[model samples]
Target: MAITSANQLELLQTAEAVAREKMIDPGLVVEAMEESLARAAKSRYGSEMDIRVSIDRKTGRATFTRVRTVVEEEELENYQSELTVEQAKQYMADPAVGDTYVEEIPPVEMGRIAAQSAKQVILQKVREAERDRQYEEFKDRAGTIINGLVKREEYGNVIVDLGAGEAILRRNEKIGREAYRPNDRIRCYIKDVRREQRGPQIFLSRTAPEFMAELFKMEVPEIYDGIIEIKAVARDPGSRAKIAVISYDGSIDPVGACVGMRGSRVQAVVNELQGEKIDIIPWNEDQPTFLVNALQPAEVSKVVLDDEAGKIEVVVPEEQLSLAIGRRGQNVRLASQLTKLDIDIMTEAEESARRQKEFEARTALFMSTLDLDEFFAQLLVSEGFSSLEEVAYVEIDELLVIDGVDEGTASELQARARDYLEAQAKAALDAAREMGVEENLIAFEGLTPQMVEALAKDDVKTLEDFATCADWELAGGWTTVDGQRVKDDGVLEPFGISLEEAQDMVMTARIVLGWVDPEELASAEEDETADEEDEA
Candidate 1:
């Protein structure tokens, strides 16, 4: 095709049509055309001749030019694209080393091959621009619901056609075995929007907890407004779900508002979820109170919380145990997800037996360690003295508070407990030394003789070993594996060392061993303080 033979204004018209069809800027289409034309010009001229093209925005007249950069004699590498100062002097009166010399050139009359190449370039650029437009339009819409037509299904994954672009709802993200036919209307949450080599990929989800939250937001005006808020949501996809909500306006009950006047709001969400049963509970700041509320339809006799482990124990009546746990532990699992805590539910009878077992264990420990009879050891255990260390170090007045325990009897108990502890410590110290424990570690503050022995057994015999250990390695923590909390045993965990205390001890060891710069720590601490103050 002859470039000059065609109507010049056709360039602008074509650009406008492509831009409108692709929903992109017309200027971008013009730029792509200019680039394609330049490539064709380079093919006609020398490929290394530095050819460039510019089309006038209004007239659509294509202007081609060759650019040659001025450089020093030693730096002139590309003879076709660059020129030395001496060579450029003929083009300019006074050419500098960095100046470029652009000269006008005739436009190429593209052949069939060149024209096809240009067409390919234009299509590629238009596709890219379209993908970018689709991504920009849908990125901010994530976490919200959108309606689309089901385009097709690929390996159980449904592809939905939004008016602007296509989105994918993976099989695992669909609510149970929900199937869709071509052109069927479907609503989904925009889970994510990602840019890929082919185009922007919009991921849709129907089983996400956020999907339920968004559905409620659309159905409940109070949630859409600032009057009520959805605090947490847990779902079993098509089977069942739970949602906790709170209200800012005291007059508006959050759960009741969400439930609606005739169960309309919650029912709407339930219908969308394929008849998934929902348990709506009120949000509470107190975790125990919240758990009690979360485990609805079953009365909780007692609640015990282990804050450090992020676990809770719930005691219910014998008859209510199965109801509390729900079908196949689904109820408790959803409650655990909602509260962000691991729950162990048992009957009130089981709880009483467990308490009795613990009391017996403590009583036996006191009887064997302090050389006291059953009655006296039980008395000490009943007084809340669980360990020999507590009995040895507690104030004399606390021991005197126990029945039939005067100052003399308290002194005798203290002497026995200390003697036993000291003897145990001596034996542990000997064992640690036998295991290559160093004096530096023994002299280190905070760690007891038994702790040292434990560290030695764990291969942390030197102060350097302690400094190199991670906080979680020295203080036990819970790990979630396959959605179950597993206990990680730490060397110092038996001594009741917390994560914070382990961190402090490690930092102190590092400082004492000259492994850490105290001044740098101080500087970092000051920076953190400044950041907190600024946030406040």
Candidate 2:
């Protein structure tokens, strides 16, 4: 082969073009190409059975060559194929049968093949290096918004130039209410950055809910300063968004502050969000009230919470139901998501019906004493003791201990209880007479005239009737002849007996009667007994 001046110039030009295309140093390409050609040449005629072609990158010169082992007999077709050890020793001072001897062959064409293979390897490496570089650049940018130039649209997505790389803005990520033009500057969230065959592929979005949140951060000085915080946010992108905000200082009205004076601040955020409507609600610690406010423009009459279910039923006027639910259920849906509640909306009328049912159920618990004073009825309700049985079974002293009761009332209540029991006993006795137990004795001997007078006021007559009385209802939990507790610190203050004396007398009466329940005795003993003993 002949090396021509024109051929050398052409190869030089080809090397420069290939290096430029692959972004590599032209000198490295030339070195690699020359090394590969030399190895090919050795493969073509080396001791084993073939010869090869070679190239000189610097000189544009090329050749073919064969290599063979020195052998005993030169029986092979070419001298390069084999040589006798004795004969090889003449050409080489120390030649062995297995040793390879290189034989230079006539020149050959290899410049084109070497150049093509070199270009392929260079391009593949360049592509991989580019991918790695791009991945490193964008991975740290996730969760932040970046500005990108609109490059072109492929299929339905817009390819964006992000400085050193490109990102894809899919149709779903685009603000549906807005359009983009070529070369337009746009802000998009770096939703994700992933490695791909071409390079690091970035996914961008303009309609993510965080888009509005980011815009708020950018617009609000208070938010940036951390004086106000965004508790939660929900969006119907391209249409509306709801954000619950809280201020660390009570002096700051979170909603008003976020909205800015006359809507200036919020409008700026809205503009950035492509005019998406923003409702800034003040965050509340009270869940019911917070939820009520989250469904704004709708006045809430009440919020009923079912703690076990984490559900809230809100009662609003009929007119506000639509407002509460929003357009196409967007308002309530966002409210539920923002507050993490399953919200049910009801009208005032419906709530009234439910409350009435509760009241009726409470009323049904009383047996015969439904005609009690309305104030007493309200007291029962306030104490959360809504049933007659609860008031009936409570002891007189315990009833007086309730928040609003007093001792004097508790004593009067005890007397009434005795009378009511006596009435029941009489009724039972009548039933017994019609059936049988008429032999039972009625004993008023131990009772004082004052005690008898107190029961007579309520119309009590018999012991059988007294046994059926509810002490708490009659005594109001405080027993008093005047306006004092019957037993003040285990003593009768009027009689000047320490608690010990009252205890002894009551025990004496219980032992003497053998049938008296001490708690049922009106007094330890009548004053007449003391008067008679003093006279004796």
Candidate 3:
């Protein structure tokens, strides 16, 4: 083999010099160079042959070799045509029929191929090293804020140059109202950094509520020192925001402190948000008041909650309702998001109507009990019964016994027992009228008259027979008995009935014979109501 010339020596020297300067291992550079040689050879010579190259690190000399398999086919090119067994003998002393031989080829002209290969290998190594450096630099910056220059905007996203790398401030991450220009000094919360073939990819956001929260901590001393805590924050980026705050010290006003003197503290935050309104509401233990405060500057008169609906109905003045609801519902919408309450804002009129319905319901319960005698009456007055139904149906007679109600007083309690039965009788007659009872049938009995008079004597307790009686008898049955005008027990005697029996009889009679039958009464009443409605 001939010794290499100074030009080859110079190439080796140049390769080693480039390796040292780029801080890449000389072995890696050599391996890359060999890979390039193989690729170029494959492209030029095809797969029918194989070529190999090696660089000796110590001497900086390059060597070339060729390989071919032992073959039985006489037609094969390399072995059959060139290396005869006598020639191959110099390569292998023990060469056999199936064994192959190797021969080193002297260095060939590879100037163009090696130069191109070296250029590509250098580029690849440089890329790999740059990638490794970026991975190490940005890996520790996740979940934190990093300073970067606004390099430029690309496709609506701002590219930030973090001295060691670049990050993207995507359109979504940039606060909508904040603008960015090249070289603008801005602080963004570094959300994450990831590795890709290109380099370390960092993502930044200025719109994250956490970003605002972090900035507040910087501006508010209490927050930094841990004296004040931000319990929750809700925001409509570029419009309004609500922050709920609490303080450990009882004397500190959480809202006031966050607002700063003359609005200085919160103004800094507002400026950051481009004049978006900020409401610093004090955190509350009571949900009602907390909700009230959440919809600030729009006075809340009352809040009606429907927990099952996960909703709250807030009543403010007619004027304030709009404010409470906010423009395009943004105010209440943010409040609802913050509090997780489906808020419904209402005006004073709606609240008043709600209260009136509630009042009527309560009044009905009280009105249904107002009529009893002295003992029963006073018992009711004492026990909250203000109606006749209470006296008539006092289930616990022991209540009367409790207040020293004696035998005669107790017996007097039954006076209206007949009157109640009589009233029930009149209600049936009215119901009959509604059922299209002939006016003549109602007047035919003057249906309630005889029953009322007989009840006065405690002789007739109901309207069953009165409902059965001819109208002439009903109108005249209350004849004077021994100068006192009264319907005689004789009137009910015709039915072989006692006073209690008379009362029940009247109900049954009114149900049956009073004109229209009882079953259709409700529909009849509804029809009458409809007819009246039509007439009106």
Error of 1 at 37 (Å): 1.4
2 versus 3: better TM-score goes to? 2
Candidate 1 segments exceeding 4 Å error? none
Misplaced by over 4 Å in model 3 are 1-110, 132-136, 192-200, 249-252, 306-308, 355-536
lDDT of each: 0.93, 0.68, 0.68
Q: Pick the candidate with the highest lDDT.
A: 1
lDDT of 2 by residue, 74-175 (tens): 454456467678767766888876787776775434466644654565556556655676788789988788998999987779999987789999998888
Candidate 2 residues lying further than 4 Å off, grouped into runs, are 1-110, 249-253, 357-536
Across 191-265, the per-residue lDDT of candidate 3 in tens digits comes to 888888777788998777777788789899999999999888888887889999999999998999999999999
Q: For model 1, what is the C-alpha lDDT against the true structure?
A: 0.93
Rank order (by TM-score, best first): 1, 2, 3
Candidate 2 — what's its lDDT?
A: 0.68
Worst 10 residues of 1 by lDDT: 1-10
- Pick the TM-score winner: 1
lDDT of residue 355 for candidate 1: 87
